[model samples]
Target: MPATSHPTRAAVAWRWVALVLALSQLAAPAVTSALAGDFLASGATNRALITPAGYAFGLWGVITVLSAVTAVVIVRYGLGSWWETGILIDICIVFVGFSLWLVIAAQSWLWVSVVVFGVMVGALAHVMRKLIRHRDDLTCPSWAATLATVTFGLYLGWSSIAWFANVAAAFLDEGWSAEGWWWQFVVLVLASVSAIGVTLMLRGTLGYVAGVLWALVAIAVGAAQRGSPVLVSTAAVAAVVVAVVAAVTWQRLGRRARISPATA
Candidate 1:
């Protein structure tokens, strides 16, 4: 990939553009408040049987703040050179799509927002998946590339579950009935299992683990508030198990990387 394909005369400036885009969340949240009588909205607490408690949405704030940091360091480390032209372009598209998704969400375009969100997820996942393999493509410091990878991984991981909940809400909105309380409970349990299953199969990345753990714990908390012990226990157990795996994986990986050449 030639630098001409993606290089900017002002790499830092382009990064600021991306960072500002990330900050657009300062606007009214796409997830409308239930108090506003918009329960059908994408972010509303009452959107679905699987919809998490309102408190769970606070994770967005944290994810965005960290993303801002990632955006900055990525350029400083050399975003233009860190990624191939295609990847760089896709990353830009992801930012633009993310902004659009929020805009559509604010309009209560539930289904449209889901489509936009899926696009953003796909783009981001592409960047995250190819990131480590392309480390040699980077002109930035090694730490910068690693940090950006982890940051995106965390956001991507959480967004994975959010997408799941989003789809569940959309279907429920479209009259997909649970059919019974037992089936409803079963669905939620399946969701918990799916979350853990994905996390376990994910490449060895602590950020993915972190994001999944946070979402699962919040899911558990949300279910508890809703008085669903089955979902609560399911989510809580999955979260704990995932957390332990993340810790152990991080420890082992860190140790192996630190091994002296002679010790190998």
Candidate 2:
């Protein structure tokens, strides 16, 4: 009758679901790519890529690794604690639903893809709230929860931005092109918002790292598009500046946490 004695039915069910979803994601790039090529060749869409963010999609692998680590951590804890149970359920719901939706959207139903991505963002945000609220109870040495939380936040935030970019690109390809500096303005706005949100979520060193990654990806994309070299360079420089600030902030927070009796 002990809480940690054996795996509950819910836990076993979720484990199976997670296993299947993880395998599906592993197979996704090949499957989705083939389907996308077919769609483009048939003139269903003018695009040649499955994701708007290009190489940014690799972050999903990082997410999957983190999720696997989290699952291990949860199992090690014996699932006695409500916090572990809650986190496990949240992750299973998020990953399984998110992966299936992306596969379907990439293969077909391009327009409805946006809604699927939105649901993912919402699911991850819920997980974030849970983590922050129960940060004190998370004492796993692997730091799985913390790492997963931040990684998921970064992925979701960047994915949201990429979604908007994809939608805009699709519209433009459909003869809704922007004029003057409108597209640039739109990209800048989206990047700024995403950067700010990431900064708030990550805070300190991790935040700085996340910010630099985001800024670099943005600049790289701009440069690849043959955008103004000066503008791209400026973005790169700005990213470095934000990175420095984030490092300093992270260090300060670490120092404070170390000195605090609770952390001590």
Candidate 3:
């Protein structure tokens, strides 16, 4: 791969860009809060059944720290591989989209924010999938690449549940009440299933599983507090199911790792 060659100036520039973007997330809470409200406050104001508790939003802090660390790793060790370059570009897009989302949300463009959030998720997912698929192929330090992969994986995992919450909030904004809405519960089920599916597909990437589980657990907690017993039950069930799937995925990944070395 071309990444096996010397890192080019362009690659170095992208690496720095990625690093800047990562650090900028540390400011997102203050910036977004000033523009409108903090992310959790905004979601709470536009309450939805799937909206997680305030504690869940704390994941943003964790993700921000991990992102900064990953960016520094990439800048230090990125080998100009195509995947490295692609990831840098995609991650930048995610952060830019997030800034745009804050503006859109401030304007109370709930529907528009929905669309923008989807695009951000897609971009993050692409970066994460690429890193996972090509992890072993990268010419960069494997530990560095793995850290980058986990950072994006965690981002994507959180976005999976968040996207649904965003959709539910949009519906509420448009005056669509959850009252008498059996289908809303169905949507929650779908959200859980989707999380499980992604974890399975990713072969139990630990960061991804951790992110999804964190959100789901928070959903259950928030639902119980909000007196949405049905949502609480659904989210609890989903969390368990996701845990089981992740365990299976880990086993499979372990088996693959064991067998591949023998074949080699």
Candidate 4:
């Protein structure tokens, strides 16, 4: 029943570095938004924060908050441990990569930015899995990890959709018309399926709910663009699929809880 020792100076210094990096990234959007006056607005040539759908693109806040929490947790628990090292590495790589992607995207390297963002998302997923396995070692608030996992997963899923949207938008802007309406239908089906898969993989009903909200927000933005009915319809379908999946998942989890003992 002895008290644990505090983290070493090195660990504390690393956490401070993480905090600084995270805050810098989080503040970038506000700086750009103020100085450039919608330069990063949706469809703008310098758009880095806003997507084609005009969502505020606040994933940076989520990323920053998570990174800060993770850093604090590592500092308090001593990153000398294997689990702490692994988690710290994951957080650093993913967050730094994501911040770099924002810069690339802002420079109009859309395709390169998309790939980098995808890698960041994959890294986040890996980090979440590792955290879940070592959940007991995490000393932060439960809500911290829960929010981090859910936000990271949903953001990844949504960004995947946005990546395709960016490609499609670029193509359209370049005068490449779709061969037929069928392609739009295909996009809709794929988006819906991807959302459902991501939701299920996260195993959180709130994650699915977040996905649905994101889908709807995307659709609303698409509608605002005076886009084709086909595209709008696709977004609508994706939202519906997310909602239904979330409901089913909630019911299944509820049933399992009911059949089990409260303390078991």
lDDT score for candidate 1 against the true structure: 0.65
lDDT (10s digit) by residue, model 2, range 46-157: 2312212345556667666655665555555433434556555666666766666556655656556656666665666566665654655555443655665566556555
> TM-scores across all candidates?
0.76, 0.69, 0.91, 0.72
Q: Residue by residue across 103-126, what tens digits does model 3's lDDT show?
A: 777777888988998998888878
Rank candidates, TM-score, best first: 3, 1, 4, 2
Each prediction's number of clashing residue pairs = 0, 2, 0, 0
Q: Which ten residues in a row have the lowest lDDT in candidate 1?
A: 33-42
> Which candidate would rank higher by TM-score, 1 or 2?
1
The alpha-carbon deviation from the true structure for residue 218 of candidate 4, after best TM-score superposition, in angstroms, is 2.3
The local distance difference test score of model 4 is: 0.57
Error of 1 at 54 (Å): 2.0
Which consecutive 10 residues in model 4 have the weakest lDDT in total?
A: 43-52
Badly placed stretches (over 4 Å) of model 4 are 1-14, 30-52, 55-82, 131-139, 169-175, 178-185, 205-208, 262-264
Task: Note the residue pairs that clash in candidate 3.
Answer: none
**Alpha-carbon lDDT, every model:** 0.65, 0.54, 0.79, 0.57
lDDT of 1 at 116: 75
- Clash pairs, model 2 backbone: 204-250, 205-250
- Which candidate has the highest TM-score of all? 3
Specify the highest-lDDT model's number.
3
**For all the candidates, what are their Cα RMSDs to the real structure?**
4.5, 5.0, 2.2, 4.7
Summing lDDT over every window of 10 consecutive residues in candidate 3, give the lowest-scoring window: 37-46
lDDT (Cα, tens digit) per residue for candidate 4, span 163-226: 5555554454455454334554565566567667766765544643574457555654655465
lDDT of 1 by residue, 195-251 (tens): 566555555577777777777787777776666777777777877877777667667
